[model samples]
Target: MFRNTKMRLGGVNILLLTIVISLIVLYRSTSYCLCKVSPVEEAFGQPMKSQPRPDSGEHRVTCHIPGLESRKQFYQYFTEKEYKCENLRWFGSRDGRKAVCMDMEFYLVPQDCHVLSFGINNEWSFDDKFGAMGCKVYSFDPTMGKADHQRSQNVQFFRLGISNIKGQRKVGMGSRFDFFEVDRYVNILERLGLTNTTIDYLKLDVELSELEFFQDVFRNTPHLLRNIKQIAVELHHGYHGKGLNKTEDITDDSSDMSPISTYQIFWQYFHELRCHGFKLFHARRNGRWTEAVWGNI
Candidate 1:
């Protein structure tokens, strides 16, 4: 009986060892393994749902800003935080009595972001709460599968898209958040005379391939950042080891998006956000990590 028990223990050890080795292999081999692809449309040019995503991804962590260790603290995955907020128009507390924090430089969003959906996953939840006191909320997902309209109560949705660039490759992605490049979004806002409006909250959940679109915005549209008191940006790293097909091979087009991994693009952008005076106060790794930060300056 003792021999048999020892044999069982040995088997369990071996199983654990195998599992650890597999995880290490996958992590090193894959660029951003946590991120996934849409089976329906690899580029997801159609509306899958209508939930406004404050930033991106499903997993997140939240803590009372100016938190006290006397209480307790820990991390939870695949869970959500109640976007408790008063209308942005009201002169009230920002986060909760305290703010949700990140680990970076420490920039907390001044307003609540109730995301309805992002990219192809459009039917999630901003379903819980709607707006903040003294704040106006809007969603710019091209994945809405429409032109212009109101999606939810106090929620204005727009479908104008950037695709890739001004004259780069275009998609049938009329409104389904199927495009890349973010400069066009800025251009649209500029034209609307809303460029100067303070965006207490904003989210960018576009796939990793278009991460450069954000870098371009911070570089060229620094003024736009002034309006955004806080941002829930989702910076995807790699394409989960999935190699992208070259445009030249697929369509022989010279003005196609130069294929690059999401990691290369997003890492550069993260550095850019840092230089802009925002700091990270919270971050959690789910399929992807969703973090909350606030501005120090």
Candidate 2:
């Protein structure tokens, strides 16, 4: 009777050990499945989601500008803040002309999307890429020397340029001879019958004219911005040279302002945009220019 009981106890221990090994194997397999990479992530080269570290503070940090003399503080404001976007896709040239965060949550669907590309100086790669995604792209470049026509199935090139003023104005690159005509944002929308339509994306690479264009839009026609979902603009500063002829009537104190003051103005504009519910998602610096993308949340 004692030997039989010993054999039965040994069999029970063996069963328990088998069950433990099976559970360990099952847990490891489940973990592997959970951590598997998705095809979309693999194609886009996006990093796999990992467990957050305890020391890593993945929270948004606010930048406070105390005075205009804080040039270090101004640049720090641009670099310190973090605006998280899950899916960001690049569209345009491999060089600096491309846009970031085009595939953000608000801009998931590319179909029937309207893209206004300002400052396409013969670089159609960005416009063409978005156009191929079923977006109707309107490319503007007064300096391209190309007449207004359909460049592709969905892309349209225009000799028109963006300006604060609605009427014809002479624009040049520090030269008296070379000049072009440009119109206001509101006027262009009215002409294109898009006054009531929502603009999916508005890209501005209009050299140094972006400051004036932004001032006009935010001050004169604040309502126009309500229709725009996303804005990607290359903000130009510290360039006081004569690029585009300034309107003699419109007072632009930017030229008079010191570099620190100019930075303050840019920060103020960005702050105003934030107040209007626009969040800056991505920013890349190329030389002295900073390409910033703000999405209306």
Candidate 3:
């Protein structure tokens, strides 16, 4: 009877051992399956998938182009300048709405302050605020249709575009739509009886065309820029804008202007501004572009 009991006990132990082994194997299999069905991997491919490198072949091609070093130098100089909040305080929406320097010494006028705002992409927060402060704002944008004129009672909206030259020319960059019927800045200002008048603030965001526009204004209308107390500009300085490679030929024969490097154009424009006694007090970076505020101090 004792022998039979011991044999049964041994058999029971063996059965328990077999069940433990089976459970271990089953648990491992289930874990493996769960890993294979990971939500992150299923949604956006494998986590270890290769990504595009920051330095690509195109970067290598354009990396050592001429004027790049000068641009870097200028950029270093630009970033190193010290700015005090008291003299140049930030105004408007912090999220790029109308964020610009107040320049207490320059922008704050007593009364009858005039502002010449160029480039209207349906953004008028800056205009509206200044107009509320009793400033006569003249906003120009040739792209606007007739129905959208006089967007605000205080701001006088004109269906005209500003350019270095007068008349219509197809203006576009990359694969974007081109603009037509753009007018010259000098002619428009003269026609509006704005000559000899102090433009308290001159805001420009004319895309890549500002490169030429600045050059033209500096050459033809020096007094216009001088009379302006403050100049706030969004400088677009990428390959798509005025910063194309010098070797690339411009197919537009009507433009009369020769192709120039980004560094050359910017250097000339900034140098001219500095020569005209405009101080670069505030500069904010927005992706590939910069919002530069120059005040007459």
Candidate 4:
């Protein structure tokens, strides 16, 4: 009877050990299945979905201007702080030369208006549109081959380029042409008996000289642009960077000039205009370029 009891107890002990080992194996397998990470999770790694952008101050240590690192950020600042797009009326072609912004107030003006357009690359659609609206438009361009002045119904085309200069200066490598500075052009307008006249609309599309022209205007004749109702300009900064591509490139060869990037200089001039009470209203992107419209309102 003693031997039989011992044999039964031994069998029970072995059965209990087997059950415990099976439970431990099952537990380990389940734990491993839960811990195995998915391929998508492994690739994402950084948790971009859950985290905020570091530049937005959500993850930064200190606060400052966030949108200045890349082109995306630059435009974010342009649209948020610089551009004031409200109740705007887009006119002309969506992708043509006649494109412009005609605010409600300007669109309903009873009296005749005047336009000073710079850099006409053989496209007079904008000038023609304004002229049809009874606005006297003057187009200036030195690249028109001849200095012969041409006139339409209410629009006049002069082979004269606008800039900030003391007198007439010849431009171009060969077959040069004379270009007028801001003061000279204003004086010419005065001589033409348009004294105390306010330019209702100012349009500019100078290939790469727009920055220099702006600097000249601000440094010499800031008041020239003070009363302008609206200003539209196309910026060409897609080449090597922003600002005049040729100017920035040749700056390295010049001695009297500093090595400051043209992009930086452009921002400075642009801010100066803003400080003078010009608020951006529209921005149009054309591939690598951008056209911006500014108004006092």
Using TM-score, give the best candidate's number: 2
Candidate 4 per-residue lDDT over residues 1-297, each given as its tens digit: 999999999999999999999999999888845654433335435221222223222221231222223344345545654544445654445443534455564463524788878776777777777777888888877777756465787888776665555345544322333344333444445544554566778887776567657865565345556557788877765345332233444334332123354444555556666766677767767776778777755
For model 3, the superposed segments whose C-alpha errors exceed 4 Å read: 1-68, 82-96, 99-104, 146-148, 241-243, 246-259
Arranged by lDDT, best first = 2, 3, 4, 1
TM-score of 3: 0.66
Local error of candidate 3 at residue 141 (angstroms): 1.6
Estimate TM-scores for all models. Answer: 0.47, 0.68, 0.66, 0.61
lDDT of 4 at 12: 100
Query: lDDT of each prediction vs. the true structure?
Result: 0.42, 0.71, 0.64, 0.59
RMSD of 4: 23.7
Model 2 clash pairs are none
The Cα error of candidate 2 at residue 237, in Å, is 1.1
Residue 30, candidate 3: how far off, in angstroms? 99
lDDT of 2: 0.71
- What is the number of backbone collisions in each predicted candidate, taken in the order shown? 51, 0, 0, 1
The sequence of per-residue lDDT tens digits that candidate 1 reaches over residues 162-234 is: 4334433333311322343233545556554565554544445544424445654554344445455545544
- Ranked by TM-score from best down, the candidates are 2, 3, 4, 1
